[model samples]
Target: MKKQLLVAVSLCAGFIASAMADSRVTIHYPGQSQALVLQGAANLEQLTLRPELNGRTWWPGTVIAERTASGIQQQTQQQTQQQLLARLSAFSAALRGDNDGELAGSVDRVRTQLAAMRVTGRQFVPLDPDWIRLHAEANRRLSGEYSVYTLSRPTSVQVVGVTTPAGPQPYQPGRDVAEYLQTHQRLSGAEKNVVWVIQPDGKTEKVPVAYWNHRHVEVAPGSIIYVGFSSWSLPRAYRDVNEQIVSLLTHRIPD
Candidate 1:
């Protein structure tokens, strides 16, 4: 597949410097954990999806037929799956402070692995170079400070007035839904979920999956993102995965 558009958004709380030369990254994939030290100029594809990464498995003709349009055998089907998973994972990681997998390993793993495991409704998404850069910066930011900021000052958001398996829980807006799910693993397996944004002036808006993926849909201080159920699986499975992640920063699953 041809490369898609890449946007470089700087979400740093303060300061921007020249991109670093070399960086070490740890990628946690389903059934895999890859660690690589990379040059800033290195493209993500080098580490993610390549013929070698799959270990000498040539593209199955049928898998190619489904993924490529007509003459785009440049990349294989497995490569595509890996690319999409990486993008989804990075976005989910950004939601609540730095509790990427730790806060919700069980739930996040389900979301990450299931999306990779699905047969139909799969699409290849180009790796977001900016995401890698942002991650590197976040890592560097943490290294300079004596203590990580996540511990000193917590990072969280609120979901107001939502019913759950526990029933009528208070809308305490201090923890990101992703972080909440990490500790409360009981509510992870629900099949369907929806996302709602509570505006500043007592207004509410339902955000579509596409809207959430756009870099423009940033979460502000008082904005409330609440996930509700529409169905077991979303219109597009990737959409379900993406929404689940954004909802982790702003989700509400009912029991």
Candidate 2:
């Protein structure tokens, strides 16, 4: 009788262990989303999300950005893709004054980012696949899954001001913006030569500093938006926001 009881106990414990192992990976970024990505082969086809995001949620359809052992960039791409879908769904739902919980917050965050952009009128550019791939690559590197990444090269860092075109200008260290001031002391703000910068794209351009990208808008008359920058998309998954943003932005912009 004791042997049979021991066997029953062992079976119960084994069941519990299996249940725990089968639990989906939970990912959440407060104002973001709380869902599960199933544990399975990374190469699953039914879902666009990395192994973690495939079937863990009640998604209406396939999502984007499959996670990898690499960087959080996969999450960033997924965030953008999810935001896009949410926005479309939300707008249509407004006809009935309905708001889906998961999508509402995501769309709101996207709105806040857009409102912060200088080109307030410009709509959110559709998420690019190249951006998605680059994000995944960067995430892999930053997450230590990869040793490193070779940037395509710095392109242009265009600078603008409260009321001027700055016109695809070069990156300046101490001029328009002080974001990229380095240890080199040869350049001074008064020197027009000081603001010139070469970007990662192998394109020699002018700027006050190595501002990441060449797209920006002016905030009001005196306030300005830094150009050559990426849309600072929030990581919709659980991770460091600034770290993810900088990684995705500083990574080579998608081709």
Candidate 3:
């Protein structure tokens, strides 16, 4: 097995600044009614094929070999909001001021919408070094095992979307970055799983397996891979994760 490029993003939001020293963070998500203390960072892809490092940043998506009752689907923040809105549409109809995700086949639409944003845990009131408060305004009616919340304002999502009805967005890698790594090349067998790399655009990068040819490779923060996913991983997951959370304005979170 090789440490493929993985992007574990989103879960980094709302971390308690009380970080120890090395790289441990206690994240308190909305609807969680609890906090998650994760050390190091990793992604579902990396953790699936390698060892986990405590106290590091994390990644976003997971590459599953097959689908299950709970499979991950890539989605944009707008899509997430639209889906949530649709859930409560019957009670709160769009007064002709809606952007999308309305009308006809709502039941099936709701299921598909959730299926896409579904990570592996409860939906969250995404937080950040800055303060942002999202409430269970819309999805309150449909809340259950998977809690939900709505942003106070609009936000953007960066993860790449694949196999969408509209198809994945244009993802042409940058020439500057591509050329830089090509010139700096000096990796060996499986030892190359040092730090994962992700483009700011939200698309994931592989953990380059040029070193030992082993299955796994570790990485550094802001380098690559954010959070990890697996059977032994965290009990909860997050959907609609974004950068620079701006939902809660009551308090300012520390970066």
Candidate 4:
């Protein structure tokens, strides 16, 4: 009788252990407060966003999974090929609609983004075969099997300063001074030797272009880029103008 009771207790514990092993993964959508908890092999196809956006698609974005005593815990995913194709399609459509010849330069920018994404741990990773595999492996390794992502638009950053044909211009994704100088006609005539990034925090950071590719540089949304001759090299009149332009173009955080 005691042997039978021991056997029953062992079976019950085994069931509880199996149940605990089958954990769920969490995914967060853009502009939403709540998160989705999925169990086992949650692929990109399983992800659905609310109030679908017209021109936006799901791109892998990082988020804080939880806040601990140590610091904020971040969750990320591997990139997929579908996201790349979607972005390329959008850029192609933009090129087709380019009546002003300005968008002709965007092709190279799109290619640059594709190139930068070749490596791992990129900021924006799409859901592809490899990504899904990685996601599964990650879930198996981590507790709670947590994952988070967001939807994003193609072009987030705005460009303004001396290089634009008009006053301000829009920069496509993955574009930097390297690609910008290649396509836009240089109007300043003073030699655009400096590239300045005006961040959302109202701070300026100088970006030096080593090659026309400038593969390592990127800017955030609403940030302004100033491309022009260095202020030190310019005459006082020109320097004042450049500073004023950069100052005015700076992005201000909402009060």
Q: Which candidate has the top score in TM-score?
A: 4
Error (Å) of candidate 1 at residue 118 is 8.5
Error of 3 at 196 (Å): 23
Candidate that scores best on lDDT: 4
Misplaced by over 4 Å in model 1 are: 1-76, 96-103, 111-186, 189-255
lDDT of each: 0.32, 0.31, 0.25, 0.43
Determine the C-alpha RMSD for candidate 4 after optimal superposition of all C-alphas.
15.7
- Over 35-121, each residue of candidate 4 has an lDDT whose tens digit, in order, gives 676663333333322223112333322321322233223211112333443544554455457552333343334334333321221
Reference-based TM-score of each model = 0.21, 0.22, 0.20, 0.34
Per-residue accuracy of model 2 over 1-255 as CA lDDT, tens digit each: 999999999999987766543322224321343443344222222123443343333221111232346535455554554444454345435523553443333434333443232110111221222344556542221111111111122233433211123323343433334432332222111122223232222122333333454322211111122222122322234223323222222222221
Task: Give the lDDT of residue 213 in candidate 4.
Answer: 29
User: In candidate 2, which residue ranges exceed 4 Å CA deviation?
Assistant: 25-255
Which residue runs does candidate 4 get wrong by more than 4 Å? 1-10, 22-26, 37-59, 62-129, 132-139, 145-147, 157-177, 180-255
> Cα lDDT of model 2 overall?
0.31
